[model samples]
Target: MNESNGHFRPDKWRIYFIYLIAAVLFAVAGGRLFYLSVVKKDFLQNQGEIRAVRTVSIPATRGMILDRNGEPLAVSTPTWTIIANPRKLWELEQDPNAKTTPQTEMDRLAKVTGLGRSWLQEKFEVNRNKAFMYLRRQIPPQDADEIMAANVVGVSKRKEYKRFYPSGEVTSHVVGFTNIDDAGQEGLELAYQSSLQGTPGKRSYLKDLKGNEILRIGQDVSEHPGENIELSIDLRLQYLAYRELKAAVTQNRAASASAVILDVKTGEILAMVNQPSYNPNDRSNIEYDQLRNRAVIDLFEPGSTMKPFTISAALRSGQYTTESIIDTHPGYLRFGRQTIRDLGNYGKIDLETVLVKSSNVATSKITLSLPQDTVWNLDYELGIGSPVGIGFPGESTGVLPSRPKWHPAEIATLSYGYGLSVSALQLAQAYMVLANDGYKVPVTLLKQELPLDGRQVLPPRVAKSVVKMLESVVERGSGKRARIPGYRVAGKTGTVHRVGSKGYEYDQYNAIFAGIAPASDPRLAMVVIVNDPKGRKYYGGEVAAPVFSRVMEGALTTLNITPDLPEGLREVRLEPKVPYRLAQGG
Candidate 1:
């Protein structure tokens, strides 16, 4: 009977059972807490971010291209892109189930955005299934501000940059331009892309469901501005050269023309321009033909412009002097049943006259005397058949025929610039060597500090001697038309027939003039080439020399280069339309 309370014994173990139940419940919760805090943390955090936070690309500004004088050639201006999260905006307008339909909302978007309702609707329809779309890119900031003020849901604004060329087509071939994405497409813009394009940055921030920022998360990464590049271009000289080249090209009815000016002492490219230049800002209409930097990319036989190098090579051999005479009783030289002709018989001319008159015969005689290796080596040293190392993209190496042996005919043609080709820049570099007292400096489009110590390509005495002869060519020979008042110009005229599919096209020619200004102590070297003139005349002296003179005159004046000639000297004006037959471009 005392055991009658057997069921009553439950109270004795009830506290332990309660403790056991509590312990099991606690253990289950701890496991769940661990899973939530550790194993599933990343996935949950990502899901939260997907619903609330947004990441966007930050655009970095491209650098400004400046002239050495601190003039802006290419610059980046702030622009805005109108963007929309179509799905978000659609949902925002639809959640209330309001009277406004998606089309009505889009029309309102177009009206506020200044875009036609049709365009807006079409744009929205194309991407209605998607979340993001660009409404319009590169609109003015004022327009973007107007759109922002319209309180259009899901329509957002982003900042970007657009490249502008202050000089436009005038510097198109040198300063170049960028594409719609702000990447360099041509000229120096492409060459210095890495140095000019800055790194973009990012930021993370807390935002509301409406996509409004509540607070910034962590430190905002700052965007680094692109480095400013000061180029060697002198805008004044660039424009002057461009105008004259354009005029000559138009007047001559030429297919194209190119010109380059260099600071001979520094080996800096002061100006480089080409005809048919396109506006870098207008990329959509640009033709493939107008995209090349012709001065550095296009190659043509330099004709008589190549003669000076031949003379320099010969003089270096110690076997010839500027006064060394080469007999030419006949007007041409015959080698292996091939004849090399002069404009006429430049009979018994000295080496100086060989260059002064650009006598193919005399040059051939001198060239054949030097070892083929000597000639090629000299040419290579001057940068012929090689890139001028200006960092221009697609720069031509030209065509230098390599052989252990050369036929007398090959030597003859090469001496006078046929059977070889060179870019206009290469021609300028070669002339710079002659102008810089036989030192060949690495040419550059960047401002150089005293120029890399030049390689001695020719004896200084020999280079000076050739410069003197070039002075003669400008003062009295074929380059007379290139003479600028108060500046003793030294230059050679070249009119070489363009080699065609069949051979030389007799009527088509490349008229060229390569020159050094203030010949007494040369400070500038320039080259001008007019290709395939359709006008009545096409001679280097007539077409190219005058362009050189006009450009050089402006350059000398703009740079305030002291006049070497007497103050009273006046420029000799030559008629533009005259039939001036001077030394043929080789």
Candidate 2:
């Protein structure tokens, strides 16, 4: 070693160079330490939290769908969804020597969840790369408990809900059901989905080394439960309608049928039911055909049920009266190439008699005499060719002539309930106007404590006149069979030809009866429609009117209304009352 001066000293440049290198290294290390402990401290903590934190849902129960009397029509039951960590399942599959191989674990799941083994395996294989997967949806809680007891690795259960329709196929078309995720698919459920669905809550917490997710869970937010829906439907009436309609359908071998009941005072739908209903609870083999709420969604030519409205239009013009005489003697009238005929001529009868007879010739004479716009305006006022606004899903606004222009033949056809279409709901609403003394009440599925404000349609006198004519119909006219024993029922029969691609299919008819009961003081209006009955008798009076009679009888008796007919004249019915029940828990 060379001395700096006289002695052997360490090399000065080498010493300086080593000191410089050491200082640079110290600065670099210090800067890195500062960056880690100060600048990036929050970032690192968040990373750690992200690894340990868990998210959880605070499930909210869906709302109950209750009838007007608070009977549960649709209810949500506690259930569980089978979930799994596919990544973990795949990891288990890769290990041939593992005690719980993926197949073994899946077999246990399949057994508990009632899923096929092949399905489980195929699903798992397809989702091998996925971190999460839904194995099954809406299993009974007990089933989930049994599955959880098995402790299949990577598999778990999450709390959820399932919709159960206690009324089953009876109220299936009205109350409807929900999907696996609990979304409404049809009927009132679909119509009031936003209000019926509840908000899901959230929770977050940190995980410990034991992997105990339950212990680590902490609430971050609370869930809001859904609001209960009180529908205008009367469960008793619904059952009655459903039972009778089903009976008629089976007896007559009809394609389908629909029945609706309305409160005359408030315009609330008392009951609505349809045939060809699907079970919402068991949708394994659901066909789209069985899902329609035919009462609200199906449109048909209303035929003679529309005659009362035509009478209203005529009387509204002040040019006609109930006693005004019309000659239907020839029993037919020629308009262009079309001939409007009566079932049989009633000689020369009053205008009211025309409706009672459902005479195509007489009603046409009266309608053709009226101003064209006046007839169309009457239809518009009656909620025809429009939504009744009962808030049903896929509700039909039935087809009407796009323009005001009506050919002479078209006007004649319109007079006799042709060249225009209407839904059963529209028919019901129009009858409500007659029942409410010419007040066109807004039809609603929701219950109202008092009758809501409605536009005055016809004069009270005209409305009473029409009702009188309808009473005549039930008394001795085509709708005679619809008469209730203790009640003076007023209604009309409609047997319209079903229109097809080529033209009207005369052989295929929609039999319908529209009536308001207790003619002494109106309370209920009902409509019954039987589609394409293949029986020997296809008249509305024969098919649809009978259903109306039974339903009105039951409803009247159930509501305990006093007999409006003379004491000795009240007819006796022997039908047993059906009980309403709640959804059964498994």
Candidate 3:
């Protein structure tokens, strides 16, 4: 009886201990539940939501670029990108009867996406283990639809933006182009990229078991559209300038060419063109040489075209007058080890004659007589060797050596426009100073709200004198080819040898002409540059001047600018032969 009772007692104690442990566990569990519901409820809810939701980015539309006439220069068009889920593709590959071979899969993708089979194969093979992959971008809508319709488990299509240039290479230099990601990469596109790139927004929604969006759980953030840019370029003038310049390039068999037209009153760039151009739509096959915008990017010595500025400076400083005379004899002047020579020998001439003849010796003598400080100051005021103030990418500040760096020979060389470098735009701007009656307007690619209020870089009288001299150039000097039949054109011709890596290439030259039309009251300023013409005639007068005449004539006529001369007045013919005279003593 005692043994049985002891065993029963042990069992009873075990049961009691078990009950106490159960009660303690239950209390602990209740406390844990309360803590979770009160203290960590928000954290637990967030963790649960994180596992079920996915976020995505939506790209915004880029802005359109329009010309001064409201013509589209650059625009965005809808496109599609193809994405593949590798896991789905892998599942298909595992099926014995499924299209498993990379070749077959790539062929199918290429057929639907319009990409090459080998290219698609390489992309597909890049990471076979990746769950998602971009098969192609920039696919046309029709092609994208076809690919999506194939219902390949992993493949999907998303809308994207692609850039389109309606004018193609005709306005490439000014309108510029964007990259694959629809971001501006050059020209005006890049200059105002931030303003032209729109903001992207986000949307969040709840998806059901089948992945169909069912309920909106959160508010969507709206996107901000990019602002459109209106440029100062006149599309008609741009087309005219491009056609004329391209014709000149082809006719002369030149290496390249460029032209720019600007409004004299507003400094608005009406048209800008560069030949040997590339279609932004097909940049993949473009040669680097063909893509250069020579008007702003390339620099060359201005040759005789720079004579006007030097003469104007001398006139403004009271160092000379229109009637000021210098003795130039033997047609040659020796400075240091170099001897500068004129086209021919002349005894003596006045400032007007010096400019009319574009005499190297005479101009050198004049520049040398001026104080070095005056020359340097004049150059700076004229915007030489300085930024053009036009917001263009890859613009060059043409080299204008400091006065202290000048060698005696350089003074003579610079006088005739050989030792100094200036971009085509710079030359045009300098000529504009004379056209605008001494005011130096900042060059711009944007349309002005009002007529430009320019800085006075030269006295009005001095500028007038230079204009008269430039008029003489078109009338009786080397720029005679630049004259229009009904217009009083004023301009200068430049022909300079191209500097090569080894040295100056004697046969290679850049032919240039900068001018303004209806000289009685200037309206438009233009510059034309033809590089390395292999034709029989390579001179600026022969090659570039005619282009200037054609383009300027068309531009003026298109803009309805009346001729300065009366209806009955006959076109002025170039003087048969102006008496050659040297103004500086050698």
Candidate 4:
């Protein structure tokens, strides 16, 4: 009886100890639950939410570039980009029994998307460890749809924007092109890239266990669309000028060519063209030389076309008059060690006759007698040796040697356009000074609202006399080929030897013509340049003047300018000249 009683007492003590331990554990668990649910509840909830939410960037649409007449020059079109979940692709690769390998997937993608298999393979290999990767960007909607329908594992399609140039090569130099990422690359695109590129916005949302967007946990942010740009280019005129310039380059077998048409009164760039142009849509076949926009980028000695400036400057300085005579007998003048000669010998002649005959000797004598300040100051005012502020990416500030840098012969050479350089655009703008009542208006490419005030660069009487002389050039001088039957055209011809690595190449000449139509009341100022024409008649009158005539005629007609030619006059013919071989250094 004593032994059984002792055993029961021990068992009861053990039961009491077990109950005490259980009570302590229950209180500790209650305290922990209170701390987590009440004290740190907001922090714990935020941590869980962050793990489930993701923010994504939404790209905005790029701006459109339009011509002055509301024609589309450059625009953006909706496209698609192919993305991949690299982790999912890796998982498939790890499965030995999987039907496809990463290489096979890439090959399939390349076949459907017209991309190289090697390129896709490299991209896939680089992002094998990443969860998301871009397989291709700027894909057309049709191609994107095909890829989507194929049900390729780990692949997704996102909408994007791609640039579209409807005018193609015709407007390439003016409107420019954009890159694959929808960023502006050249021309106006490069000039206004910041204003044309839109701002991207962010979007955050919650996804469920299956990765489906369930609820909108964040506000929808709005994106800022890019501002549209209106240019001063006229699409119809631009096309006409491009076609005519291209025909001239091909017919003359020229190494290159360029043209620019400006509104005399408004200083608006109506059309600009360059030969050996590239199709922005198919950049794969583009050559570096063909990509050059020669109208604004190239500078060359203007030859006889620059004669008017010297004569104008002399007239403005009261040093010479339209009837002032210069003795040009012997057709040449010796200055220091250099002797300058004219294209042909002329005796004593007035300014008008000098211009009509384009006598280099006469011009050299006149410019040399003038003050150095007159020459330098006149060039600066006419926009030479300076930017035109046309808002282009690669405009050249043509070289006009400073006064101190001028040699005795330099002034003579510059008088007839051999020692200095000027762009086709600058030439056109300078001519506009004579066309617009002796005022030099600032050139612009944008569609401005108000008319720009003109700065007087020459006297009205002097400008009128210069215009008459220019008319005589077209009517009876070397620029006769530039005449249009139904219009009164005034211009000058320039045939200058091209400077090479060693010296001037004799047969490699730049044939150019700068002109304004309806001399009585000029409207369009056009400058045409044909470089290194391989033809027997490599003169500006033979190679470039005819092109100017045709382009100007067409452009003026398209713009509905009234005809101002004298009755009974007929359009000049453009007969192809015999091809000439390029000579060595002149």
Candidate of highest TM-score: 1
TM-score of each: 0.91, 0.88, 0.88, 0.86
Candidate 2 lDDT over 36-152, as tens digits, reads 889999998788877787777878888999999999999988888889877787686567787777878888888877889999898988998876889878888777788889888
Per-model C-alpha RMSD: 3.6, 7.0, 4.5, 6.0
Candidate 2 ranges beyond 4 A from true positions? 1-48, 89-123, 208-220, 345-347, 402-404, 568-586
Candidate 1 residue runs with Cα over 4 Å from true position: 1-36, 39-44, 92-94, 97-99, 209-212, 571-586
RMSD over all Cα atoms, model 4: 6.0
Cα lDDT of model 2 overall?
A: 0.83
Task: Tell me the tens digit of each residue's lDDT in model 4 across 476-516.
Answer: 78788888888988999888889999989865899999999
Query: lDDT tens digits, residues 162-254, model 1?
Result: 888888899988888877888887888888899899998887777787567787767767788899999898998998989989998899899
lDDT tens digits, residue span 48-75, model 3: 6655554455778889999987899999
Question: Which ranking of candidates, highest lDDT first?
Answer: 1, 4, 2, 3
Worst 10 residues of 3 by lDDT: 577-586
Q: Candidate 1, TM-score vs. the true structure?
A: 0.91
For model 3, the stretches where C-alpha displacement exceeds 4 angstroms are 1-50, 92-111, 114-125, 207-216, 403-405, 567-586
